[model samples]
Target: MKNKQEIPAVIVADAKVFDYLKEKVGERKTRTEAYSDLLDKSLAGFISPFLRKQDYDLQPCQCHVTISDLATEWHWHRATVRSFLETLEAFGQLKRTRLAKSIVITMPVQSGQSSATFVIQRQPDFAIQLQEVLSDWIVGKTTSADVGNLCGQVVHQAMTGMTGYESRHCPDSHIDTASAHAGKQEEEIRKTALGCIAHAALQRVLWKSRFDDSSPLIEFFRHDLDEEWVSFIEASKELAELILDTEACETTFDTDDDKERLKSLRKPFLSLLARTQEPAD
Candidate 1:
Protein backbone atom coordinates (compact mmCIF):
# COMPACT_ATOMS: atom_id res chain seq x y z
CA MET A 1 0.00 0.00 0.00
CA LYS A 2 3.02 2.23 0.32
CA ASN A 3 3.97 3.27 -3.21
CA LYS A 4 4.58 6.03 -5.69
CA GLN A 5 0.99 6.82 -6.62
CA GLU A 6 0.10 9.03 -9.58
CA ILE A 7 -2.92 11.03 -10.65
CA PRO A 8 -3.01 11.22 -14.45
CA ALA A 9 -3.69 14.66 -15.95
CA VAL A 10 -3.27 14.10 -19.66
CA ILE A 11 -6.76 15.40 -20.36
CA VAL A 12 -6.91 18.87 -21.90
CA ALA A 13 -9.23 21.40 -23.55
CA ASP A 14 -7.54 20.83 -26.92
CA ALA A 15 -8.38 17.63 -28.78
CA LYS A 16 -10.28 16.44 -31.83
CA VAL A 17 -12.74 15.34 -29.18
CA PHE A 18 -13.12 19.02 -28.34
CA ASP A 19 -14.14 19.72 -31.93
CA TYR A 20 -16.45 16.74 -31.87
CA LEU A 21 -18.24 18.10 -28.81
CA LYS A 22 -18.80 21.44 -30.56
CA GLU A 23 -19.84 19.92 -33.91
CA LYS A 24 -22.38 17.76 -32.14
CA VAL A 25 -23.73 20.37 -29.84
CA GLY A 26 -26.47 19.17 -27.48
CA GLU A 27 -25.14 15.72 -28.23
CA ARG A 28 -23.26 13.26 -26.03
CA LYS A 29 -19.84 14.16 -24.60
CA THR A 30 -16.96 11.92 -23.63
CA ARG A 31 -15.64 11.89 -20.04
CA THR A 32 -12.39 13.44 -21.29
CA GLU A 33 -14.04 16.49 -22.84
CA ALA A 34 -16.54 16.89 -20.03
CA TYR A 35 -13.69 17.10 -17.49
CA SER A 36 -11.83 19.63 -19.65
CA ASP A 37 -14.88 21.84 -20.07
CA LEU A 38 -15.62 21.68 -16.34
CA LEU A 39 -12.11 22.90 -15.53
CA ASP A 40 -12.35 25.68 -18.12
CA LYS A 41 -15.73 26.87 -16.85
CA SER A 42 -14.59 26.94 -13.24
CA LEU A 43 -11.51 29.08 -13.90
CA ALA A 44 -12.95 31.94 -15.88
CA GLY A 45 -16.18 34.05 -15.92
CA PHE A 46 -18.80 33.80 -13.25
CA ILE A 47 -20.51 30.43 -13.15
CA SER A 48 -24.01 31.23 -11.93
CA PRO A 49 -24.74 29.80 -8.50
CA PHE A 50 -27.25 27.01 -8.89
CA LEU A 51 -26.88 25.45 -5.45
CA ARG A 52 -29.06 26.23 -2.40
CA LYS A 53 -26.36 28.64 -1.17
CA GLN A 54 -25.56 31.37 -3.68
CA ASP A 55 -22.50 32.49 -1.72
CA TYR A 56 -19.46 30.23 -2.34
CA ASP A 57 -15.85 30.79 -1.28
CA LEU A 58 -14.54 29.62 -4.65
CA GLN A 59 -11.10 30.04 -6.15
CA PRO A 60 -9.83 30.08 -9.75
CA CYS A 61 -10.19 26.37 -10.48
CA GLN A 62 -12.64 25.57 -7.71
CA CYS A 63 -16.44 25.76 -7.99
CA HIS A 64 -19.73 24.26 -6.97
CA VAL A 65 -21.17 22.58 -10.06
CA THR A 66 -24.58 20.99 -10.00
CA ILE A 67 -25.31 17.80 -11.88
CA SER A 68 -27.87 19.74 -13.84
CA ASP A 69 -25.25 22.30 -14.92
CA LEU A 70 -22.89 19.55 -16.08
CA ALA A 71 -25.70 17.77 -17.92
CA THR A 72 -26.63 20.93 -19.85
CA GLU A 73 -22.98 21.67 -20.64
CA TRP A 74 -22.24 18.17 -21.90
CA HIS A 75 -25.68 17.49 -23.33
CA TRP A 76 -25.92 14.43 -21.17
CA HIS A 77 -28.53 13.41 -18.61
CA ARG A 78 -28.15 14.66 -15.03
CA ALA A 79 -27.79 11.09 -13.83
CA THR A 80 -24.92 10.56 -16.29
CA VAL A 81 -22.98 13.60 -15.09
CA ARG A 82 -23.47 12.69 -11.44
CA SER A 83 -22.28 9.16 -12.13
CA PHE A 84 -19.19 10.45 -13.92
CA LEU A 85 -18.22 12.76 -11.05
CA GLU A 86 -18.54 9.88 -8.61
CA THR A 87 -16.35 7.78 -10.89
CA LEU A 88 -13.77 10.55 -11.08
CA GLU A 89 -13.66 10.69 -7.28
CA ALA A 90 -13.18 6.92 -7.18
CA PHE A 91 -10.10 7.25 -9.39
CA GLY A 92 -8.80 10.07 -7.17
CA GLN A 93 -8.79 12.43 -10.15
CA LEU A 94 -11.30 14.85 -8.65
CA LYS A 95 -10.86 16.75 -5.37
CA ARG A 96 -14.43 16.75 -4.16
CA THR A 97 -16.38 17.84 -1.12
CA ARG A 98 -19.91 16.45 -0.86
CA LEU A 99 -22.54 18.86 0.42
CA ALA A 100 -26.22 18.69 1.39
CA LYS A 101 -27.17 18.28 -2.27
CA SER A 102 -24.14 19.49 -4.23
CA ILE A 103 -20.40 18.75 -4.54
CA VAL A 104 -17.48 21.15 -4.74
CA ILE A 105 -14.44 20.16 -6.77
CA THR A 106 -11.07 21.89 -6.58
CA MET A 107 -9.36 20.97 -9.83
CA PRO A 108 -5.85 22.33 -9.55
CA VAL A 109 -3.13 22.34 -12.24
CA GLN A 110 0.73 22.38 -12.28
CA SER A 111 2.70 22.33 -9.00
CA GLY A 112 -0.46 22.93 -7.04
CA GLN A 113 -0.76 19.28 -5.97
CA SER A 114 2.69 18.81 -4.47
CA SER A 115 2.90 17.57 -0.89
CA ALA A 116 5.33 16.93 1.99
CA THR A 117 3.74 14.12 3.95
CA PHE A 118 5.41 11.32 5.88
CA VAL A 119 5.65 7.99 4.06
CA ILE A 120 5.94 4.57 5.67
CA GLN A 121 9.16 2.75 4.77
CA ARG A 122 8.53 -0.58 3.13
CA GLN A 123 10.21 -3.87 3.92
CA PRO A 124 12.39 -5.27 1.13
CA ASP A 125 11.00 -8.07 -1.05
CA PHE A 126 13.81 -8.14 -3.64
CA ALA A 127 11.32 -6.45 -5.94
CA ILE A 128 12.54 -3.85 -8.41
CA GLN A 129 11.70 -0.31 -7.46
CA LEU A 130 10.64 0.79 -10.93
CA GLN A 131 7.71 3.16 -10.82
CA GLU A 132 6.64 6.65 -11.86
CA VAL A 133 2.92 6.06 -12.00
CA LEU A 134 0.41 3.23 -11.56
CA SER A 135 -3.05 3.37 -13.12
CA ASP A 136 -5.34 1.52 -15.55
CA TRP A 137 -5.54 4.75 -17.62
CA ILE A 138 -9.23 4.46 -18.43
CA VAL A 139 -10.27 7.15 -20.94
CA GLY A 140 -12.66 9.04 -18.72
CA LYS A 141 -11.47 8.06 -15.26
CA THR A 142 -7.95 9.15 -16.24
CA THR A 143 -5.50 9.30 -19.18
CA SER A 144 -1.76 8.98 -19.86
CA ALA A 145 0.63 10.20 -22.53
CA ASP A 146 1.38 6.54 -23.27
CA VAL A 147 -0.04 3.73 -21.20
CA GLY A 148 3.07 1.67 -21.90
CA ASN A 149 5.53 4.27 -20.63
CA LEU A 150 6.05 2.68 -17.21
CA CYS A 151 6.34 -0.85 -18.59
CA GLY A 152 9.06 0.27 -20.97
CA GLN A 153 10.96 1.93 -18.14
CA VAL A 154 10.62 -1.19 -16.02
CA VAL A 155 12.13 -3.33 -18.76
CA HIS A 156 14.87 -0.79 -19.33
CA GLN A 157 15.79 -0.75 -15.63
CA ALA A 158 15.89 -4.53 -15.37
CA MET A 159 17.95 -5.02 -18.57
CA THR A 160 20.33 -2.30 -17.47
CA GLY A 161 20.72 -3.84 -14.01
CA MET A 162 23.21 -6.62 -13.22
CA THR A 163 20.52 -9.19 -13.94
CA GLY A 164 17.96 -8.92 -16.73
CA TYR A 165 15.36 -10.01 -14.20
CA GLU A 166 15.26 -11.44 -10.69
CA SER A 167 12.86 -14.26 -10.03
CA ARG A 168 14.59 -16.87 -7.92
CA HIS A 169 12.36 -19.63 -6.64
CA CYS A 170 14.40 -20.85 -3.74
CA PRO A 171 12.41 -23.42 -1.82
CA ASP A 172 10.92 -21.91 1.31
CA SER A 173 11.27 -23.79 4.58
CA HIS A 174 8.05 -25.32 5.92
CA ILE A 175 7.66 -22.63 8.58
CA ASP A 176 8.41 -19.85 6.11
CA THR A 177 5.98 -21.29 3.58
CA ALA A 178 3.27 -21.57 6.19
CA SER A 179 3.80 -18.02 7.37
CA ALA A 180 3.81 -16.57 3.89
CA HIS A 181 0.70 -18.47 2.78
CA ALA A 182 -1.16 -17.64 5.95
CA GLY A 183 -0.23 -13.97 5.65
CA LYS A 184 -1.50 -13.85 2.07
CA GLN A 185 -4.80 -15.46 3.05
CA GLU A 186 -5.17 -13.15 6.03
CA GLU A 187 -4.49 -10.13 3.87
CA GLU A 188 -7.35 -11.09 1.55
CA ILE A 189 -9.69 -11.61 4.50
CA ARG A 190 -8.73 -8.26 5.99
CA LYS A 191 -9.32 -6.52 2.65
CA THR A 192 -12.78 -8.01 2.42
CA ALA A 193 -13.61 -6.84 5.92
CA LEU A 194 -12.24 -3.37 5.12
CA GLY A 195 -14.27 -3.14 1.91
CA CYS A 196 -17.46 -4.06 3.74
CA ILE A 197 -16.67 -1.54 6.45
CA ALA A 198 -16.10 1.16 3.86
CA HIS A 199 -19.30 0.39 1.97
CA ALA A 200 -21.36 0.32 5.13
CA ALA A 201 -19.79 3.53 6.43
CA LEU A 202 -20.77 5.31 3.22
CA GLN A 203 -24.29 3.89 3.29
CA ARG A 204 -24.76 4.86 6.91
CA VAL A 205 -23.60 8.41 6.19
CA LEU A 206 -26.10 8.69 3.36
CA TRP A 207 -28.84 7.13 5.41
CA LYS A 208 -28.27 9.72 8.13
CA SER A 209 -28.48 12.43 5.46
CA ARG A 210 -32.04 11.28 4.68
CA PHE A 211 -31.08 9.68 1.39
CA ASP A 212 -33.83 7.28 0.37
CA ASP A 213 -31.31 4.87 -1.07
CA SER A 214 -27.56 5.25 -1.59
CA SER A 215 -26.58 2.27 -3.68
CA PRO A 216 -24.80 3.96 -6.60
CA LEU A 217 -21.46 2.77 -5.20
CA ILE A 218 -22.53 -0.83 -5.62
CA GLU A 219 -24.02 -0.26 -9.08
CA PHE A 220 -21.13 1.74 -10.61
CA PHE A 221 -18.36 -0.81 -9.98
CA ARG A 222 -20.49 -3.60 -11.39
CA HIS A 223 -20.01 -1.99 -14.83
CA ASP A 224 -16.86 0.14 -14.61
CA LEU A 225 -14.23 -2.30 -13.30
CA ASP A 226 -13.49 -5.97 -13.55
CA GLU A 227 -15.14 -7.98 -10.77
CA GLU A 228 -11.85 -8.72 -9.02
CA TRP A 229 -10.86 -5.06 -8.86
CA VAL A 230 -14.14 -3.89 -7.37
CA SER A 231 -13.13 -4.15 -3.73
CA PHE A 232 -9.72 -2.59 -4.41
CA ILE A 233 -11.06 0.50 -6.14
CA GLU A 234 -13.91 0.94 -3.67
CA ALA A 235 -11.60 0.81 -0.69
CA SER A 236 -9.27 3.29 -2.37
CA LYS A 237 -12.17 5.67 -3.00
CA GLU A 238 -13.20 5.57 0.65
CA LEU A 239 -9.64 6.36 1.69
CA ALA A 240 -9.69 9.31 -0.72
CA GLU A 241 -12.92 10.60 0.76
CA LEU A 242 -11.40 10.56 4.22
CA ILE A 243 -8.37 12.50 2.98
CA LEU A 244 -10.59 15.11 1.31
CA ASP A 245 -12.51 15.69 4.55
CA THR A 246 -9.33 17.01 6.18
CA GLU A 247 -9.03 19.90 3.72
CA ALA A 248 -10.97 23.01 2.85
CA CYS A 249 -14.32 22.13 1.28
CA GLU A 250 -14.14 25.22 -0.95
CA THR A 251 -12.55 28.61 -0.42
CA THR A 252 -11.79 31.98 -1.98
CA PHE A 253 -8.12 32.62 -2.77
CA ASP A 254 -6.41 35.85 -1.84
CA THR A 255 -3.65 35.11 -4.34
CA ASP A 256 -2.67 32.41 -6.86
CA ASP A 257 0.07 31.16 -4.53
CA ASP A 258 -2.36 30.94 -1.66
CA LYS A 259 -4.70 28.93 -3.86
CA GLU A 260 -1.89 26.65 -5.03
CA ARG A 261 -0.95 25.79 -1.44
CA LEU A 262 -4.53 24.84 -0.72
CA LYS A 263 -4.64 22.37 -3.60
CA SER A 264 -5.18 18.66 -2.90
CA LEU A 265 -2.15 16.96 -1.38
CA ARG A 266 -2.18 13.48 -2.89
CA LYS A 267 0.67 11.74 -1.09
CA PRO A 268 1.25 8.31 -2.59
CA PHE A 269 2.88 5.32 -0.97
CA LEU A 270 6.65 4.94 -0.53
CA SER A 271 6.59 1.90 -2.84
CA LEU A 272 4.46 0.73 -5.75
CA LEU A 273 1.58 -1.56 -4.80
CA ALA A 274 2.17 -5.16 -5.79
CA ARG A 275 -0.07 -6.50 -8.54
CA THR A 276 -0.70 -10.23 -8.28
CA GLN A 277 -2.55 -10.59 -11.56
CA GLU A 278 -4.13 -8.47 -14.36
CA PRO A 279 -3.00 -5.01 -13.18
CA ALA A 280 0.56 -6.27 -13.69
CA ASP A 281 1.94 -2.73 -13.98
Candidate 2:
Protein backbone atom coordinates (compact mmCIF):
# COMPACT_ATOMS: atom_id res chain seq x y z
CA MET A 1 0.00 0.00 0.00
CA LYS A 2 1.23 3.46 -0.80
CA ASN A 3 1.61 6.07 1.93
CA LYS A 4 -1.03 8.79 1.89
CA GLN A 5 1.69 11.37 1.29
CA GLU A 6 2.81 9.66 -1.92
CA ILE A 7 1.56 11.27 -5.11
CA PRO A 8 -0.27 8.95 -7.50
CA ALA A 9 0.78 8.95 -11.18
CA VAL A 10 -2.87 9.57 -12.08
CA ILE A 11 -3.01 12.79 -10.09
CA VAL A 12 0.42 13.93 -11.26
CA ALA A 13 -0.66 13.41 -14.85
CA ASP A 14 -3.54 15.87 -14.47
CA ALA A 15 -4.35 17.77 -11.28
CA LYS A 16 -7.45 19.18 -12.97
CA VAL A 17 -8.71 15.62 -13.35
CA PHE A 18 -8.71 15.06 -9.58
CA ASP A 19 -10.31 18.44 -9.00
CA TYR A 20 -13.07 17.46 -11.40
CA LEU A 21 -13.71 14.22 -9.49
CA LYS A 22 -13.66 15.82 -6.04
CA GLU A 23 -16.13 18.43 -7.25
CA LYS A 24 -18.48 15.71 -8.48
CA VAL A 25 -18.17 12.84 -5.95
CA GLY A 26 -17.50 15.31 -3.14
CA GLU A 27 -14.75 15.42 -0.47
CA ARG A 28 -16.05 12.63 1.76
CA LYS A 29 -13.98 9.59 0.65
CA THR A 30 -10.48 8.57 1.78
CA ARG A 31 -7.71 9.23 -0.74
CA THR A 32 -7.21 5.53 -1.37
CA GLU A 33 -10.89 4.96 -1.88
CA ALA A 34 -11.10 7.90 -4.32
CA TYR A 35 -8.11 6.62 -6.28
CA SER A 36 -9.27 3.00 -6.47
CA ASP A 37 -12.89 3.73 -7.27
CA LEU A 38 -12.16 6.33 -9.95
CA LEU A 39 -9.27 4.32 -11.45
CA ASP A 40 -11.21 1.03 -11.49
CA LYS A 41 -14.22 2.46 -13.27
CA SER A 42 -12.17 4.62 -15.64
CA LEU A 43 -9.75 1.80 -16.51
CA ALA A 44 -12.42 -0.84 -17.15
CA GLY A 45 -11.44 -0.84 -20.82
CA PHE A 46 -8.09 -2.41 -20.00
CA ILE A 47 -9.55 -5.08 -17.68
CA SER A 48 -12.54 -6.19 -19.74
CA PRO A 49 -11.93 -6.83 -23.43
CA PHE A 50 -15.64 -7.43 -24.08
CA LEU A 51 -16.61 -4.17 -22.49
CA ARG A 52 -13.94 -2.43 -24.53
CA LYS A 53 -15.26 -4.05 -27.68
CA GLN A 54 -18.77 -2.94 -26.80
CA ASP A 55 -17.65 0.67 -26.31
CA TYR A 56 -14.96 1.16 -28.99
CA ASP A 57 -13.77 -0.36 -32.22
CA LEU A 58 -10.06 -0.64 -32.93
CA GLN A 59 -8.93 0.06 -36.46
CA PRO A 60 -5.41 -0.57 -37.72
CA CYS A 61 -5.18 2.60 -39.82
CA GLN A 62 -7.58 4.95 -38.05
CA CYS A 63 -5.94 7.17 -35.42
CA HIS A 64 -8.74 9.68 -34.88
CA VAL A 65 -12.56 9.53 -34.63
CA THR A 66 -15.38 12.02 -34.53
CA ILE A 67 -17.46 12.21 -31.34
CA SER A 68 -20.58 11.28 -33.28
CA ASP A 69 -18.83 8.29 -34.87
CA LEU A 70 -17.82 6.93 -31.47
CA ALA A 71 -21.31 7.53 -30.10
CA THR A 72 -22.98 5.68 -32.96
CA GLU A 73 -20.48 2.79 -33.00
CA TRP A 74 -20.69 2.21 -29.26
CA HIS A 75 -24.50 2.60 -29.01
CA TRP A 76 -23.97 5.33 -26.44
CA HIS A 77 -25.48 8.79 -26.29
CA ARG A 78 -23.38 11.41 -28.01
CA ALA A 79 -23.30 13.65 -24.95
CA THR A 80 -22.23 10.72 -22.75
CA VAL A 81 -19.38 9.82 -25.07
CA ARG A 82 -18.30 13.46 -25.28
CA SER A 83 -18.30 13.72 -21.47
CA PHE A 84 -16.13 10.61 -21.17
CA LEU A 85 -13.77 12.05 -23.77
CA GLU A 86 -13.53 15.27 -21.75
CA THR A 87 -12.70 13.25 -18.61
CA LEU A 88 -10.00 11.39 -20.51
CA GLU A 89 -8.48 14.67 -21.61
CA ALA A 90 -8.66 16.06 -18.09
CA PHE A 91 -6.89 12.98 -16.64
CA GLY A 92 -4.03 13.02 -19.20
CA GLN A 93 -5.25 9.69 -20.62
CA LEU A 94 -6.29 11.49 -23.82
CA LYS A 95 -5.22 14.59 -25.70
CA ARG A 96 -8.15 16.03 -27.68
CA THR A 97 -7.24 18.02 -30.77
CA ARG A 98 -9.93 19.57 -32.88
CA LEU A 99 -10.06 18.32 -36.50
CA ALA A 100 -11.61 20.28 -39.36
CA LYS A 101 -12.84 17.51 -41.66
CA SER A 102 -15.36 14.72 -41.24
CA ILE A 103 -13.84 11.24 -40.75
CA VAL A 104 -15.09 7.94 -42.16
CA ILE A 105 -18.02 6.48 -40.25
CA THR A 106 -17.90 2.74 -39.56
CA MET A 107 -21.46 2.84 -38.22
CA PRO A 108 -24.64 3.79 -40.13
CA VAL A 109 -24.51 7.32 -41.52
CA GLN A 110 -26.18 9.97 -39.43
CA SER A 111 -27.94 12.79 -41.27
CA GLY A 112 -25.67 15.54 -39.87
CA GLN A 113 -21.93 15.87 -40.16
CA SER A 114 -19.80 16.13 -37.02
CA SER A 115 -18.22 19.53 -36.41
CA ALA A 116 -15.03 18.15 -34.92
CA THR A 117 -12.99 15.07 -33.99
CA PHE A 118 -10.82 14.20 -31.00
CA VAL A 119 -7.65 12.12 -30.69
CA ILE A 120 -8.10 9.61 -27.88
CA GLN A 121 -4.69 9.25 -26.26
CA ARG A 122 -4.93 8.41 -22.57
CA GLN A 123 -8.19 7.92 -20.63
CA PRO A 124 -8.47 10.13 -17.53
CA ASP A 125 -9.47 8.94 -14.06
CA PHE A 126 -11.76 11.88 -13.37
CA ALA A 127 -15.08 13.48 -14.38
CA ILE A 128 -16.72 16.91 -14.73
CA GLN A 129 -19.10 18.31 -12.10
CA LEU A 130 -20.62 20.91 -14.44
CA GLN A 131 -21.84 18.18 -16.75
CA GLU A 132 -23.22 16.28 -13.78
CA VAL A 133 -25.00 19.37 -12.51
CA LEU A 134 -26.45 20.01 -15.97
CA SER A 135 -27.61 16.38 -16.20
CA ASP A 136 -29.34 16.68 -12.83
CA TRP A 137 -31.02 19.89 -13.93
CA ILE A 138 -32.31 18.19 -17.07
CA VAL A 139 -33.78 15.23 -15.15
CA GLY A 140 -36.26 17.42 -13.21
CA LYS A 141 -34.81 16.44 -9.82
CA THR A 142 -33.13 19.86 -9.49
CA THR A 143 -35.15 23.04 -9.50
CA SER A 144 -34.56 26.17 -11.57
CA ALA A 145 -33.79 28.04 -8.34
CA ASP A 146 -30.99 25.55 -7.60
CA VAL A 147 -29.60 26.02 -11.10
CA GLY A 148 -29.73 29.78 -10.71
CA ASN A 149 -27.92 29.60 -7.38
CA LEU A 150 -25.15 27.39 -8.74
CA CYS A 151 -24.74 29.55 -11.84
CA GLY A 152 -24.58 32.63 -9.66
CA GLN A 153 -21.80 31.10 -7.57
CA VAL A 154 -19.78 30.01 -10.61
CA VAL A 155 -20.26 33.35 -12.32
CA HIS A 156 -19.23 35.06 -9.13
CA GLN A 157 -15.81 33.37 -9.33
CA ALA A 158 -15.17 33.56 -13.07
CA MET A 159 -16.58 37.04 -13.69
CA THR A 160 -16.59 40.27 -11.67
CA GLY A 161 -19.80 41.92 -12.82
CA MET A 162 -22.26 39.43 -11.37
CA THR A 163 -21.67 39.76 -7.66
CA GLY A 164 -21.37 42.22 -4.76
CA TYR A 165 -22.48 45.85 -4.70
CA GLU A 166 -21.24 46.39 -8.24
CA SER A 167 -23.44 43.75 -9.83
CA ARG A 168 -23.81 45.47 -13.21
CA HIS A 169 -22.42 42.44 -14.99
CA CYS A 170 -24.85 40.05 -13.38
CA PRO A 171 -27.20 38.51 -15.98
CA ASP A 172 -30.38 40.05 -14.69
CA SER A 173 -31.59 41.91 -17.79
CA HIS A 174 -34.24 39.47 -19.01
CA ILE A 175 -35.55 38.68 -15.58
CA ASP A 176 -35.54 42.30 -14.52
CA THR A 177 -37.44 43.38 -17.62
CA ALA A 178 -39.97 40.63 -17.13
CA SER A 179 -40.35 41.58 -13.51
CA ALA A 180 -40.97 45.20 -14.51
CA HIS A 181 -43.69 44.19 -16.97
CA ALA A 182 -45.27 41.90 -14.43
CA GLY A 183 -45.17 44.71 -11.86
CA LYS A 184 -47.72 46.71 -13.86
CA GLN A 185 -50.37 43.98 -13.67
CA GLU A 186 -49.53 42.46 -10.29
CA GLU A 187 -46.98 42.42 -7.41
CA GLU A 188 -44.21 40.72 -9.41
CA ILE A 189 -41.42 42.80 -7.93
CA ARG A 190 -42.59 41.91 -4.44
CA LYS A 191 -42.59 38.21 -5.33
CA THR A 192 -39.11 38.51 -6.79
CA ALA A 193 -37.92 40.36 -3.70
CA LEU A 194 -39.38 37.65 -1.50
CA GLY A 195 -37.61 34.94 -3.50
CA CYS A 196 -34.28 36.72 -3.18
CA ILE A 197 -34.82 37.13 0.56
CA ALA A 198 -35.71 33.45 0.92
CA HIS A 199 -32.60 32.41 -0.99
CA ALA A 200 -30.45 34.67 1.18
CA ALA A 201 -32.01 33.19 4.31
CA LEU A 202 -31.41 29.67 3.08
CA GLN A 203 -27.76 30.49 2.36
CA ARG A 204 -27.40 31.86 5.90
CA VAL A 205 -28.91 28.71 7.38
CA LEU A 206 -26.60 26.51 5.27
CA TRP A 207 -23.56 28.52 6.36
CA LYS A 208 -24.53 28.15 10.02
CA SER A 209 -25.07 24.41 9.58
CA ARG A 210 -21.57 23.97 8.16
CA PHE A 211 -19.66 26.20 10.62
CA ASP A 212 -21.59 25.39 13.87
CA ASP A 213 -21.62 29.21 14.19
CA SER A 214 -22.10 32.03 11.71
CA SER A 215 -19.29 32.73 9.31
CA PRO A 216 -18.00 36.29 9.06
CA LEU A 217 -19.61 37.64 5.90
CA ILE A 218 -16.47 39.66 5.27
CA GLU A 219 -14.78 36.40 4.33
CA PHE A 220 -17.09 36.02 1.31
CA PHE A 221 -17.10 39.66 0.23
CA ARG A 222 -15.97 40.22 -3.36
CA HIS A 223 -12.59 41.84 -3.78
CA ASP A 224 -13.95 43.92 -6.67
CA LEU A 225 -16.53 45.49 -4.38
CA ASP A 226 -14.23 48.44 -3.84
CA GLU A 227 -13.70 49.05 -7.56
CA GLU A 228 -17.35 49.06 -8.63
CA TRP A 229 -19.33 50.37 -5.72
CA VAL A 230 -16.53 52.74 -4.74
CA SER A 231 -18.40 54.78 -2.13
CA PHE A 232 -20.17 51.84 -0.48
CA ILE A 233 -17.39 49.33 -1.07
CA GLU A 234 -15.18 50.88 1.61
CA ALA A 235 -17.67 50.06 4.31
CA SER A 236 -19.39 47.03 2.71
CA LYS A 237 -17.32 44.46 4.59
CA GLU A 238 -18.09 46.06 7.95
CA LEU A 239 -21.75 46.34 7.00
CA ALA A 240 -21.88 42.73 5.82
CA GLU A 241 -20.32 41.53 9.08
CA LEU A 242 -22.86 43.56 11.02
CA ILE A 243 -25.75 42.10 9.00
CA LEU A 244 -24.49 38.55 9.39
CA ASP A 245 -23.93 38.87 13.13
CA THR A 246 -27.33 40.45 13.60
CA GLU A 247 -29.01 37.70 11.58
CA ALA A 248 -27.17 35.00 13.53
CA CYS A 249 -28.64 35.78 16.95
CA GLU A 250 -30.30 32.64 18.34
CA THR A 251 -33.55 34.05 19.71
CA THR A 252 -36.60 34.53 17.48
CA PHE A 253 -37.62 38.16 17.03
CA ASP A 254 -41.09 39.64 17.30
CA THR A 255 -42.84 41.15 14.24
CA ASP A 256 -41.56 44.65 15.02
CA ASP A 257 -37.97 43.51 15.44
CA ASP A 258 -38.22 41.33 12.32
CA LYS A 259 -39.46 44.32 10.33
CA GLU A 260 -36.68 46.51 11.70
CA ARG A 261 -34.00 43.93 10.88
CA LEU A 262 -35.34 43.56 7.32
CA LYS A 263 -35.39 47.34 6.97
CA SER A 264 -31.73 47.41 7.95
CA LEU A 265 -30.79 44.71 5.46
CA ARG A 266 -32.77 46.40 2.74
CA LYS A 267 -30.95 49.69 3.25
CA PRO A 268 -27.62 48.39 1.94
CA PHE A 269 -29.16 46.47 -0.95
CA LEU A 270 -31.32 49.47 -1.82
CA SER A 271 -28.33 51.77 -2.46
CA LEU A 272 -27.70 49.71 -5.60
CA LEU A 273 -31.39 49.12 -6.32
CA ALA A 274 -31.47 51.72 -9.06
CA ARG A 275 -28.68 49.91 -10.88
CA THR A 276 -30.06 46.43 -10.30
CA GLN A 277 -33.67 47.40 -11.05
CA GLU A 278 -32.75 49.09 -14.32
CA PRO A 279 -31.23 47.31 -17.33
CA ALA A 280 -27.46 46.78 -17.35
CA ASP A 281 -26.10 50.36 -17.52
For all candidates, what are the clash counts?
5, 4
Off by over 4 Å in 1: 1-26, 49-53, 111-281
Note the Cα lDDT for every prediction shown: 0.42, 0.36
Number of clashes in model 2? 4
Q: Write the per-residue lDDT of candidate 2 for residues 1-281, one digit (tens) a residue.
A: 94655321211234344455553334334333334333433333222322333334433222345656555544556655555554334423334444453222121111133211111111122122223333345445667697656544432332221112123322576556533433332232223223444443443333333423222222223442333556346445434444467565334344665445443543434333222222111
Give stretches of model 2 more than 4 Å off. Answer: 1-63, 66-127, 160-281
Clashing pairs in 1: 2-271, 3-269, 3-270, 3-271, 57-251
Candidate number with greatest TM-score: 1
TM-score of 2: 0.21
Question: Model 1: what TM-score?
Answer: 0.36
